[model samples]
Structure formats: structure tokens, C-alpha cells
Target: MSLTRRGFLVGLPLLLAACSTRTTTTSTVSMISAYGPIADDRFPLPGLNARLIQPHLRRQEVDYESSHAKGSLVVDTPNKYLYYILGNNRAIRYGVGVGREGLALRGNAYVGRKAEWPSWTPTPNMLRRDPEANGPYRNGVPGGPNNPLGARALYLYRNGNDTMFRIHGTNQPQSIGLAMSSGCIRMLNHDIIDLYERVSSGARVLVIQA
Candidate 1:
């Protein structure tokens, strides 16, 4: 079978996903895939550059002792990490890009909704902040690999009210682990896809400022 460029890059990682400790092989491979192009994504995510995921930032289980209950999602804005609470002082940590407005959108919220290859509509503030860049897309960008919200998105809400905040995959993978002008938490497309599978609807999300 002739593998397309996307297929070759995407398949290479799955073959290596089994290389780590057997217990962690699954997570390891998934993490590796996070940096490689995706041929199976609903919208054809182009994947990420190898160097984008620094060793320290790659998805892996870490000793994260938190008061948050299991199955919750936590965003560590200052450290640029997102944790999916797995209890037992352990969690799956994924590095993310936090916008300044995303930092301002702190406190408790829940995943009121989730979507795959979700469309993106920039908030008014986002437009005002960079009209030149966001103006043409005012009508909203459709769900696809090139969209701002890449493969998956988790919408944040409180008490059934829309908080207008989101955790989603990004077309701009290079922005991971940095602050940007947008108003959401952005992850590598593959990382978001991984997160989307692990999180359930209505999972609580806590964004920590410090």
C-alpha cells in the first residue's frame, strides 16, 4: 500500500506507540501521534512539528496531587499545562497555549458541550484586538483542519450558562506553551483529540491563574 505523506507521518508514530513501557505504551504512542500528521482526523489535521512538543511538555502521566475530584479537567495557565484528573495523585498532562483573555477566564466551569472538528467564531474582543487578522473571518470559520479550532473542542459553561470560553485544538500548534491574543486554551490537534476521547460530557474544568 502506498502511504500518502500524511499517512506515512501518521503511521510512523503508531508503530512507535508500543515502544514505551507496556503499561504506558498506549499513552506514549498517543502522545507521539500528537506531534505527527493525522490521516484519520475528520478534518485532516496537518499535525505538528517535532520540536513543538518539548520533552517537558509532551503528554504523559505525572504526579499531580490536586483537590479536584477524578475525571475533572484543570488548566494550569501559568505553567501552560492542562491536566485530566485521574486521581491517585496522577493525571494526564498536556501542554497548551493560553491567551491573555483565557487567563482572565479563570475559576470553575464545566464542559457543557463537546464537538469534533468544531467551527470557530471569534468573540467581539478578539476581533477588536486584531481586526486585520480576524476581520475576514467574522462570519465564523467552518470545522476543518485549517480552522482555528482544530480536531476537537470542549465548551466551558457554568450552571447551564455559556461562559464563552473554550478548550480546543489549534491550527497554530507552534503557539503551545505561550500566551497569545485569543480568548481560549489551544492544544495540539492530536492532543485535543486525545483529550476529547478521555473526557466525558459535563466534566468540570478549573482554570488556575497561578
Candidate 2:
């Protein structure tokens, strides 16, 4: 989703001040090749067929199992994707929307909490940064039709505290594979719903620099 000037002005500072700690380790890359039409069940659009077909989502790079990382979820930002490293040269890849240049991050964290069609509450810090986002504060945006945190949310936590950054779904399918959120990583809503069903709370996550 393209960030409007309003969205940018509202999100920039929250993105910048967002910070976290990391434990770095190397791991093998899993290269995914082309395949037939694959249905991304997590993407929830009205009438259009929701599948990640070739060219749009292709296997470019794969990290084989690197000893340094045993149990970790890897996110390759430059590729606009996230991978839950399984083993050997295999990983479950999902397309994602990351933070724009000035708002990127690399690190390790665990899913603190998981929510389905999560309510969005712009933080006090977010409001202080942009008063225009005032009314959208406090209340969680309900699940279903129009919420931005589409189908699910895996809250990233550091040192047992919520970091405010999330790996969630987007109502904006166009935003997938683009740096266009309020710094939260966005996925096709259907894809995220599928992922939410697969991942348990406390799953390990690794965001890597490309």
C-alpha cells in the first residue's frame, strides 16, 4: 500500500524511535524455485482469486541450514519476505512489507502474543507524533472486513516486553512486498491467517539485514 503523506507524517517518528535488541547468528539459506499456482489462503480479497503465482512470488535465494541458527524464524528484508527456517535447505517463505529505509531493523525476538484480525490502537507515542491519528487511539480495530492488521498478528517482543513492531496482515494487498506501513511488517491477509494457524505463540523470529 502506498503511504499517503498523511500516513507518512503520522508514522515516521514512531518508526524511527522504535528500537530493539538482537542476538545474531548465521544460518543456511533455502532457495525456493518456481512452482505452479500456489494459493495464499491468508489473503482475503473480495472477488479476485487470491494466489501468489510465479514472477510475483518466486524463489530467488534460499539459505541452507547454518549451524549458528538452529531454531529461528528468518526475515530477509531486501527480498520483501519472511522465512520460518525448518531444516536443511528448506524454509517456509512468506511475502512481507517491511519498514522503509529510515525505519528498518535487524534482530531476534519471539512472538509475544498472537491475535486474529487484531484491533489497531495507535500508541500514545504515535498520537504525540501525529495528533491527526487521535480518534484511532485506544480501541482495537475489530476483526474481519476492513482492519489493517488483516487476519493475524504475531507481536514481536524483546526482553519479555512488547516492541510494538508486528508481523501481521494488511488490507492493502498492493502493499505486500513493499515498505509501506507504519513500520510493521505486513502480509497478505490470507497468508497471515494461514501463518497464524501454523505458528504458535513464542515462536522464534530473526530479522536479518540483506
Candidate 3:
């Protein structure tokens, strides 16, 4: 499929209840489809021109050790790196697209929830800033390969309230290593999926000012 600047976003089941011989039960369940490998064609294949990821300067030292701090997510906005703190000092670091100059932030938060193939609802702020992006998409865009959230989302909350930002996947892989998103941290689909699998709800996330 052709890559659209707005695409790259891509998501359930139910259960019933019954009783024994003469009984009746009712239940509700949802199933998650096992996601397949992200097709190379679905993304801009790895190439020299593609945005570089986990570049040397941003990587923790090769011999980095995993500390108790492992399993953390670090957003080094200045360097455009998001590190998935692996146990010991090592981490799987990925390049990210952060907010622009005036939009950058410094703070700490945690992942309050995680979603695969997440739907997106442009915030009121977003709609006010981009009227053309308004209209039917205001409430929320359904999750799909064409969603701007790419393939996943890890919602960030501070003091248990949504910061309205996320550590999420991006279809704009080219935007990685740059500042382009609307204050959310954007990662490659493969990278976010990998990190998503490793992190859990309530994982500590630190966004250090670069």
C-alpha cells in the first residue's frame, strides 16, 4: 500500500455465556488478533536515506549495565532518542520524532495504558490549530493501517491524569530524529511494537530536557 502522510495507523472479539444442561449464562469477552509481522512494503524499508535509529551518540554505552532502573522509558528530547531501559544498563534505544522547539517539554510521567493499533481523537487543541483536520475526524479516528498513530500507543499520565501525549508508533518514519509531531513522542512501528511488548502499565517514564 502507498504510504500516506496520514496513514500508518493500523486494531477485537466477543464471548458468550451459557449454563449447564438447563442453565443459561451470559458473558462478554473480547479477543485480540495476533498481529503479523509488519510487512516491509507497509513501511519504508531500511535504507541509508531512512531515518537513522539508535545512533551511536544516543545509545547507552555498549557495555551499559541494566540497573534496577531497567524497564523504564526515557525520552531524551534534545537527542531525539527514546530508550527502552532493558535490565542492567543496556536499553533498546530508538530514534523518535518529538514536538517542535516551542512545544518541547521536560518532565516525568508513566505509562498508564497501552493499546495496539490505537484509535486517535485529535484533541481540542489540535482541531483549533488545524481546522482543515477538523470535521468528522474530531471525535476519533478508528484504528487501522491509515491511522496517524501507526500501530500502537502508550498513554502517558502524570499524577494519574493524562498529559494528552503519548509514546506511540508513527507512519512518518521519515520524521524520526526530527521534531514534527504535536508534542507526542513518535517511534517506528517495529520499534514501538518491540518496546510495547517490553513495557507494562505504570512503567516509569522520564522525559529529560536535552
Candidate 4:
């Protein structure tokens, strides 16, 4: 639960413990306090301008209507929202930026692996689509503030094979709530860090196609 790297959650779905959630109705946690500058991180991060983000796009606990088990994740692609189902009809909602029109992942998958400040390398497809943009990073980028993967990454898998899809933090915080990624979902640095702690490696995920 500490933001440490976790091995690929091999074998059964429940290989890791269920994630604990915060759902107290009287909780006093505020937006500024949660999204403030993170100076103590390995690579210090600047505070986000919450005012620039739409209220609905900000991270918050909400009354979720879902039949999925607690700890399951649901990505509402069209709405640009990711729901961390905590059951009891509640969930923590975070804004997400998804892949463009035909590039989003769909159906079921699970967190096969989780990493803090994970390394990032462009795929062949990415290179082909925009060599001028991705060619430079073909050698890959080390994990850091400037890294495209940002502070954390959750690798998605299906049938025990890495699907090459991810739910990760991004250096472009402004991209949240937009459709501009390759195929993986993108979250804010602080939000993904918060999620990385709460979600276990084997947590199930469902990405609803747009």
C-alpha cells in the first residue's frame, strides 16, 4: 500500500489483498490540500491549478451506482472518468484522458503490474504515427518528472498476457478530460499516486469504449 513497485500479479485474481478505501461522509479532505505541490517526491512536482480544471474532472468520492465488487475499476471512456468502486454504492471518481476515437481499449482487463515512476518507451505504432514526436524517445525515457509516464503506472493485462494498455499519470496534466492519448488512460500526478496506493496489483478493470 506504500507507493512501491509491485510484481506482476500472476496466478489467481486475488493474489494481492483487496485495496482499502476512504468513504467517510464526514471526511474533511479538501481539493487544495490534496493537490498541493509535492516537494518531497523523488522529483519534486509543482502544485496543480485546480481552478483550471472543471469541478467534475477533479478527484472526489461520490455516490457510485455499480454492481461490481468493491476494489474493481471502471473506466467511463466517453465521460473521461475513472471510477474506483468501493461498493456500498460509493466510489472515488477521478478524471481521465483517453485515446482518440478509434484508439481506446475496451472490455475487461486487470492490473498485471504496478510501478512508481515507471520507465517509458514509445511503441512501433507510436513511432509510425508521429516519428518526429516519438522518434526521440525510442530509446526510452527514465522514470522522472519529465517522463511521459509520470509518477505511476498500472499495466493492464488480459488472459495473463500484457495488453500493452495502461492507466498512468502523465506529464501533461492539461490533457485530463480530453481524448488525446495513444490508447492508455491518463491521470493527474497526485491522483495517480493516490490511486497507486489504494489499488492492488490484481484489481479488475473494465474500460467502457467510447
TM-score of each: 0.80, 0.68, 0.70, 0.85
* Tens-digit lDDT track of model 3 for 46-104: 32222143233121212233343878877768767676765544454566889976765
Model 2 Cα shift for residue 196 (angstroms): 1.4
For model 4, state the Cα shift of residue 46 in Å. Answer: 2.7
Cα miss at 131, model 3 (Å)?
1.5
Which wins on TM-score, candidate 2 or candidate 3? 3
Name the 10 consecutive residues with the lowest summed lDDT in model 2.
5-14
Q: Model-by-model lDDT, in order? A: 0.72, 0.58, 0.63, 0.80
Runs of candidate 3 exceeding 4 Å displacement:
1-68, 134-136
The digit string of per-residue lDDT tens for model 2 on 1-210 reads 211100100000101112211112211121111221224433334432333422333222233444324445677787676665546644445668898776665788898999866778876665776777655555666676577777688899989999888998777777777876666788765456546666778888878765
TM-score of predicted structure 4? 0.85
lDDT string, candidate 1, 1-210, tens digits: 111221211111111111111123234444444556666655555546555466555666665656778999988787787888878766767779897743357889999999998988878887887899889999998898688888889999999998888999887777888888366899877778778888999899988785
- Each prediction's RMSD over C-alphas, in Å, is 7.5, 11.3, 16.4, 8.0
Please tell me which model should have the higher TM-score, number 2 or number 4: 4
Deviation in angstroms for 101 in model 3? 1.9
After the best TM-score superposition of candidate 4, give how far the Cα of residue 155 lies from its true spot, in angstroms.
0.3
Superposed Cα RMSD, model 1? 7.5
For model 2, the superposed segments whose C-alpha errors exceed 4 Å read: 1-65, 68-71, 133-138
Error of 3 at 171 (Å): 1.4
Ten contiguous residues minimizing lDDT sum, candidate 3: 11-20
